[model samples]
Target: MENATTLQLDPEANSNQTIDSQEKILTGDRATGSLHLGHFVGSLQQRVQLQYRYAQTILVADMQGLTDNGHNPQKISANILNVVADYLAVGIDPLKTTICLQSAIPALAELTMYYANLVSIARLERNPTVKNEIKSKSFGRSIPAGFLTYPISQAADITAFKATLVPVGEDQLPMLEQTNEIVRRLNHIAQQDILVECKPLLSKVSRLPSVDGKSKMSKSMGNTIMLSASEKEISKAIKAMYTDSSHLRVSDKGQVEGNVVFTYLDAFHQDQDYVANLKEQYTAGGLGDGSIKKILDECLQELLKPIRQSREKFIADPSQLIAILKEGTERSNDESNDVLAQVKKAFGLNLF
Candidate 1:
């Protein structure tokens, strides 16, 4: 909707358009911890589907992680490989999707510094995601400047790769808005159409609520089932899942609304008929939460078994894992440095 470029549409043309071969997509997760089921449903699954259709670049955003976890470099460092393993385990083919480390790309940091001036502190303060995170972390008056400005960094990341598509949840809409604002401003100022605008590929299953039936799934809240969670852990988490609190007995009428187990089944299970029947039986006053939980546990265990196995195999080879990251990082540098050089030349900073 926010436009720096215009599209010339033919009045008689067909509505459907073919995807461009050169179109690129960029997506990533902060390397603060291992990914969980929420990540799978929200973005990773979409990435797998998009890999062959577009040139995809997946970043392990360690620099962004430092915005919040600056005090714990060890945690960020350890989780880098874990996140990459999660990507591979979930069928992200490295040959098709370039997986890179954010810290290894110096061009991104430089771009961030330049782009920061294009955005105002007042605008950053108004960002809903940043505001929500500040409240969640209770940063009241001690909010880190880096955390507040990470949106600029994110804008830089997207434009550095000239990404045309970004997979994100509904809550991240504000962030994409900010990114496009900067993109349009930069291209206008340079008067040369330098940067590209990106569209958000909103996930169908945008979010999965917390296991305890809270508003969202979060690792910090201890309500997430890790992508590589053991069968035992999956069993325990599913068994402890929140259900209708009023249904105290097996014969008591249960409410399907706001039930966590059914929510998960709706997301993960392909057998819609069975899930529908389960919901119908659940509300009919004779079904028990334990029986529903057992079904969910088995479904989850079977779903995650291969993912856990693949993760373990990747983790066993530290050198090979590092090599993959290093290669991807090098490729990122080549791509981003070209963009950075163009940006510097546009600003008259490349006066050599």
Candidate 2:
């Protein structure tokens, strides 16, 4: 809720540099797996629009993916390109948005080390996001230190890019809050605003539920519809989506609230008036689950057709993906290293 304007940059220290007046955006996803429809409605769609309006940078956070998957590094390594492909498939232009790899940017790791000192273990343990993840992952007694401290790493990611806006869900507000805390602390220590505070740009659309309708859409849960799902796969997932169990007959009045079929229709079906009519008919006891499922199947197939095609093209040429990532990372490295220099200068680490 606090404004980023309160944090001031020391003019004398940054006098030679022409400050970028454009609002810089930093957002990303871990490379644990391919992105899903939940991503499409939630953040990916927003990122596509943001690229055209602002200075946007998408970080493929391969390093952060290792936090909980330290035992299975291959999963993270394998999906890095797949994730980038999904971005391109969804309309994120590499020419407009700089897409970089996290591990490729050494300054992020270095910044994480410096930012970690500003936060305490007790403070990290208290973060709501960290606590919930620990419980969900069932890390009970043997939590990975990296898993516990990745929030600090995230703070490093945001600050290193001097990001002014970060797209996040409501649940992720805490992470942005923590990022600002570190930025404020580092500036206090330096007696100058070497780091810029960032604010959360909350998504307007609600998160899409998994097909089961009982859980959040997640690849790890195998309950999500992937952006790159084949036609048959999408159809199969829609067929299995949870609907009002009590609506046993086409004439039986259905409950639209918890029906996953209706949920997907609301998100994917472009014609709201048509979807609304369907919902009304279904709720009034004249509609069947199969009818809505059929409609949803059509909608999803149409939505994903082009995305899947684009993703396949990018996936086929791994070198092109690599080249785009390399160029973005190189550009990002220059920007982040400059910020890192200022941070180190504040810490009096620039002995040379």
| Candidate with maximal lDDT | 2
| TM per candidate | 0.93, 0.94
For residues 291-324, could you state the per-residue lDDT of candidate 1 as single tens digits? Answer: 9998898889989999999999999997888998
Task: Give model 2's TM-score versus the native structure.
Answer: 0.94
Q: lDDT of all the models against the reference? A: 0.87, 0.90
lDDT of 2 by residue, 122-143 (tens): 9999999999999998997699
- Collision count for each candidate, in order: 0, 0
Clashes of 1: 0
Off by over 4 Å in 1: 1-19
